[model samples]
Target: MRALFWLLSIFALAAGLAIVARYNDAYALFVWPPWRLHISLNLLAILSVGLFALLYMATRLVARALALPGAVAAFRAQQRKQRSIQALRDAQRFLVEGRYGRAHAQADAAYRANESPGLAALIAARASHAMREHVRCEEWLRRAAEHDREVRVARLMTEAEFAVADRRFDVAAERLDALRQGGHRHIAALRLSVQTAAARGMWGDVLRLARQLASHRAFTAEQAAPLVRRAHLESLRELEGNPEGMVRYWRQIPKPERNDRGLVRDAALLLNASGQGELAAEAIGDALDDNWDSALAELYGRIEGGTLIERIGQAERWLRAQPRDERLLLTLGRLCLQQQLWGKAQSYLEASLSVAPSRAAHLELARLAEQLDRNELALKHFRSAAELTG
Candidate 1:
């Protein structure tokens, strides 16, 4: 299409020139000292136009020649920019592919080229650490730190992670504390904080951080359960000697978690071990009220505190709801035994045996039989208990 258009244009121009030349009755004369020259006006016009065209072409060529060096410089700069970008990209890929040595080299190249220097240095640091080049890793991390405005937060987080991996909890804590000073309790940071706290035996912090992470949806309930449970266990242990602290911490825990069988058992046992058996009984009773756990029911029979009659009454109430529950029947029988209602203890124990036999119920019956001086019956119960244990 363009060729056809140019062809028509050229033909139009030639035809117009032909018409002008055919109608040319005009002339121009020029006189010199010894020569006179005559020229057609149309001819003169053609020559003048031809000369202008030559000059335009010459000007364009000179301009291009003058710009040559700068153009070459620009082209080279663009090539370097592309190379730097490619190096940065390759470094990241190598890091992901586990090519630590190559990653470090490429990252270093990127840093020298000044392409996102902070990110480049951090990549180098990570690669160095992966290669077990501790000295080089630290050096790269320091270099990354120099670009503080660009990656201070990233550098700190990376260092904290490395510290945690090395079991340097104290150092990890220091780094995490620095992050906190900057108001960064971001999800990832909170996760690191959880590890640091747990490793340092800072159970309270572990609980707090785990809860925060869960709330942020960084962990699913199923995933968070074990962590939260562990933190509670450790926290209870930490307060083993401090009855008040243990109670306070227990109350501070979310009410829903108080019903967790494992956590409730641990808390109760710890309270009992610390000479706070009354609190232990209260915790167990409260947990049983919220939700029936056979293990907790069995534990309830052993904790030596609270009003024996009240516990027996509580067990009776649970019996109405779970009549076939052997653990509850056993608990009721033990409570009755403690209250010295020998006949009632005997009846409840027999009922528990009918529901399901347990070593605990047999042992309780053995003790009751001994109290009553029934030698043969006591011997029978003792043998049963041993058999169940075996």
Candidate 2:
């Protein structure tokens, strides 16, 4: 369709030119001292149009010639820019590949080539850190901050990570605090805070940061559970010998955290050790009622100062649900002995041994025998527990 339109337009243009030529019969004459020249009006018009077209073409050529040097320089600069970008990419790839030396070299070259110097310096810093070049790592990190003010947070994060790696908890804590105060507490910053807190044995801080990370979905439930549990355990251990402090700490822990069986058991054990057996018993009972844990039930037996008869009643209630749990049986044996129910204590101890012959059950049986004045039977039980230990 376009070709047909162009064909018709060409014919119409030719017919219009023919009509103008046929009607334009006027002429023009010019005279000089020795020569005279005459030309038709149509011929004059054609020459003038052709002359303008030639001049336009010539001017365009000259302009292009004049601009040639700048165009060449621009092309070279573009090539250099591409090379610098490629160098940065290579640096990142090498860093991921664990080729630290190569990564550092590429990053430095990219920095020299003026391609995101701040980012390049950060990559170099990471490479230096991987190579165990601590001094160089710090220098690169400083250079990164100097190159771009916006990258200072990134610089601080890198420094904090390095400090954590070096076990320099104090330095890491300072950097992390600075990040927080600057309103730059991103996921990575929070994760580094967790590491730094753990390194410093600051269990409270570790727990706080870990909970923050978990809330952000930075860690899966599986990963977060153990870390939170460990932090809680360590915090409970730190509160040892201070029953008041342990009680305060326990109350401060979130209810969801207290729901974890392992964490609850650790806290209960710590509480019992500090002569807060009532607190331990209460915690253990709450946890077991929510979700039964055999290990925690066993820990229930070791608590010293709680009402033994009440604990025994609680264990029996749990027994209705878990009749075959040997740990619960062992706990019942111990709780019965505490209440001086000699017959029931012997029955639970023997029942626990029949289900699972643990050395602990043997020891409990020996103690029960001693309480019953069966010296020979106590000696035999002691010998059997010794063999199991060996």
Candidate 3:
């Protein structure tokens, strides 16, 4: 259609020029002194203008004719590219929907058709992973890595996760080490490293990775504390066969972290074992100041003092600060009973039961009432304790 339009346009232009040449008359009105000329002015001017226009149109036609094949080639290439992109998108959708087989097929087709081999390999790897075809996943991931080092790091990280899922701790650790060595220590890599270290019971490695992660702000301080505490405890536990080694290990932990409940508890138990009651009591006191705990309460009650009064006084001080603390109240009541402060002990125990009734509280109160020669009240508290337990 365009060809016909150009042809018609050229013919009309030529005919119009011919008509102007045939009708218009040119009379030479003047000449320069050294020159002599005679011409039909309209015909010559029209023919010159028409020839220039024709030449321009002809040149344009030649250029377009020459470019037509390249244009067609480019258009076809674009369409093919579009198809490859569409195939990749479909594969991604299929993978997201968990249709692994279809996703693999689509990704394979896209891989063959697309120029972005790295992206195609990624899709293929994901599809293979979803299908549990680990061998195929590794092959595709390797292809991706070869295409780009950034892609390689990403592929290795994914592989590490898969290894961990398969309980391949050693392989996961190796992969994490490679990632860290390659300077690809992103949050995901650090997190996986932490998990792998923990799974392998590599406390040293766990502590190192956790500290790295915390330093990078990958986890909040609160989030990382428990893992750090656990790692420290595990390290200490390993030295249990050697008393000097265990004590040295305990001493090495920072004072602030040693104040944590888990570490404090472990230290108290260890101290009690080593017959260091005074140090254990001090540690327990520090731990309770941070948080009230039933275990700590019981541990405090078992410590030796001059008389039960001294212990009871210590507990009453704790209760004064935490008035509604049932655990402290119960502990204070038990200590008072031992000191023969029956009225104070009974009132405190009753207050504890009123706030939060428990088998332990009832039993303690029953024992306190018996000590006071209140047999009826003692029996009643004992029955309540039994019912609560049952």
Candidate 4:
């Protein structure tokens, strides 16, 4: 409607102009040095109008021609972007569908197409690793590393994990050590590094990494404590036959942690194996202060210079505190047998059996009865023990 209004207005102005031209009879005269001409005002107006139309058309044609190349380039760039997006989608679909071979192909195509090279390289690496293609995985990981320096640490860490998965522990360790030395000690990277070190029996490195992980809360105290202790234990084991060095290594552990039941138990067993019974007993006693364990009870029972009566008294005290504790009752009964308190031993053994019958408890009780010359009771307990053991 606006265009129509403007067109009618232009027509009315032209008619008014024509009427004015008729009345005035004015003409426009043109002179070039060699020629002179004259035209009616209306005709000149018409000619001017036609010339303006021609100029406008020509300007539009020139502008369109000027923009053609850039327009084409932009269109082509958009098409390339679309194709790259499609390729990435296809690669992701293949990966999700467990079509690793196709995923590899699609990722390679995406990479060659210059579509997010880093992402494509990562996809190819993961797909190859899934297929157990270690060489291909490494190549893709290396390519990813070369493409983006910012992701170099992450790529190298991935390669190290793959090496560890492939049981190439030495290579994994080398890569991990290099990354750590370069200050790329991300938590996952450090964890894999520790595992690699452990696989290679590098207990010192394992201990160091475990401590670092523990400090950062990457692992819980309970989880990391054992690994640290095991690393120390292995270090001590390596120094076996060198008693002085072993003792020094064992003593290096902090008092509080060294006194932990699990750590102390393992240390005691190790010391005992190395003919360090006195130290083993001391460690055992230290562990027993915090927690009572049947294994520790048995270990304590084997020590000398403590009479059977004293040991029995200790076991009875423990049992009194936990009357229904079958293991403690059994231990007490065995201690009583050692002290030749046959009646008390029988009573404790019967209580243990009533709480939780076990072949071992029955056997101990039968042995005690036999020693006390209660033949009938001994025979019956022996038959029960035999039945349970069978």
Q: Sorted by TM-score, highest first, which candidate order results? A: 2, 1, 4, 3
Residue-wise C-alpha lDDT for candidate 1, range 190-286, written one tens digit per residue: 8999888888888778777877888899988777777888889887887777888988888888888777778888888888888777788888888
Candidate number with the higher TM-score (2 or 3): 2
lDDT comparing candidate 3 with the true structure: 0.81
Relative to the true structure, candidate 4 reaches a TM of 0.75
- Candidate 2: where is the Cα deviation over 4 Å? none
Worst 10 residues of 1 by lDDT: 203-212
Give Cα-based local distance difference scores for all models: 0.89, 0.89, 0.81, 0.81
- Backbone collisions counted per model: 0, 0, 0, 0
The runs of at least 3 residues in candidate 1 whose Cα sits more than 4 Å from the true structure, single-residue gaps closed, are 1-18, 28-36, 227-235
* TM-scores for every predicted model: 0.86, 0.91, 0.72, 0.75
Tens digits of per-residue lDDT, candidate 2, 327-353, equal 999999999988989899989989999
Our tally of clashes for model 1 stands at 0
Lowest-scoring 10 consecutive residues by lDDT in candidate 4? 298-307
For model 3, name the residue pairs that clash: none
Residue 241 lDDT, candidate 2, scale 0-100: 77
Estimate, for each residue in 69-153, the C-alpha lDDT of model 3 and write its tens digit: 9999999999999988888888889988999898888888888885567777888888898788989998988888877744677
Q: Would you list the clashing residue pairs of candidate 1?
A: none
